[model samples]
Target: MNRNKLILLTAVLLLLAGGGWFLHDSGFFQAVRSLEALRAYIAGFAPYSHLLFFLVQFLSVVFAPIPSNIVAAAGGVLFGTLPGFLITFTAVASASLVTFSLARVLGREFAGRIVSKKLSEKYQGVLRTKAPVFLTLAFLFPFFPDDILCILAGLTSLSFRSFALIVLLARPWGLLFASALGGSTLGLSPWVMVPIALVGLALFLLGMKYGNQVEETVLRRLKERRSGDTE
Candidate 1:
């Protein structure tokens, strides 16, 4: 890369490293495991709690494994549903853009290192295909690895604008739902929550069983359609 691009890449890597270390040292990851703990930890930031929460949310996406939904729920409990959703939506969308841009700048070889050889190989088709249909579905669904896909998308022929549109359209429902759950705006008592929980569990089980098949089906269909158009 040119000097400027190399410098930008270095800066991004350093920021991610520093941010990862800070989150670990601050016990942000541990705190996010529990709703009360996360709420209290963010609350400890006090006058600047929202800002801290935003940082935590942003880092969670870029760093991976921190569970953005749990953090969003904590924001809901701490800041209420609307504020929580807004904060999470902004942080996550920004982080997604950052990862996408990073991969685009760094190319497939570097992205393979970041996401791992196996994952890169597994999703390599994503790089070759320009269709956003599968991407949209993956982002919207609960079972897909949405964060990694954000990085993988950068290696595709998709324009930044197309990817941004997908992120904006497909990413909000889950965050909003999680925030509302934490905010208790649903006002779901045991009677309601019990059935909802059972249904959710059922869906989760079903997703686990067939999610990959569904993804493959979508991709296969898209490829067939593209081939037909070419023919």
Candidate 2:
């Protein structure tokens, strides 16, 4: 879609999310709260609980209000440690896909308006070119707000294929972080999780370094495309 339509779509979604919040607060969407409840509600479906756990986890990530740590622990309880970690990765990957798509479809123009021109210009190139690497690091690294950064990525000119592939590669590391620290029902060590975090951090910095260069290329390509379109 063109920029104008995409912006309009973003506006609509924002409004809808606002309305959803209003309804949630007003008790109209009370069931959603129950769904978000940190209970072991997956017991009945013991055979299918693993799949169900994955779905719950994916949705939790998709929705901003639901805390991922809660879902991670739920996975540990429902699916055991190793299985829980695996399931959590699958769910997170799926949720990442949803987040990536929403940004692609509705985030492009809206993202531009939200951030500073300098930051946008500096970052847009990486988004348009090597979005996957940026996304991978963005997913693995915990400090930054992944939600906003993801929406920012969507507003740029990234191809979906690269986004999906990168997300697939990146999210497992994040799950490793989640699993080793908070998600472990079996009580994994801080030292172990620490090494995992160090690896994730290293990868994140690498992604950022490359992302800066890619951003420059993206800007050049965008400028050339605009120049061509004008001609």
Go through the candidates in order and give each one's C-alpha lDDT: 0.82, 0.59
Give the deviation of candidate 2 from the true structure as CA RMSD.
8.4
Task: Tell me the spans in candidate 2 whose CA falls farther than 4 Å from its real position.
Answer: 1-52, 107-133, 180-231
User: Ten-residue segment with the worst summed lDDT in candidate 2?
Assistant: 28-37
Model 1 lDDT, full chain set: 0.82
- Cα displacement (angstroms), candidate 2, residue 128, comes to 4.6
Q: Which pairs of residues clash in candidate 2, taking residues 3 or more apart in a chain or in different chains?
A: 108-155, 125-215, 126-215
Best by lDDT: 1
**Per-residue lDDT over 1-231 for candidate 2, one digit per residue giving the tens place of the 0 to 100 score:** 687876776675676467556535544234334323433355545787676667666655545555565466556555566677888877777766666676666554544544557666655665565555566656665534454555567676676777677767766765665554444434657777677558756866885677656545644666566567569
Candidate 1 positional error at 38, Å: 2.3
Q: What is the per-residue lDDT of model 1 for residues 11-50, given as tens digits with 9 covering 90 to 100?
A: 8778888998988898887887788899999999899999
Task: Give the Å error, residue 165, model 1.
Answer: 0.9
Q: Can you give the TM-score per candidate against the true fold?
A: 0.87, 0.53
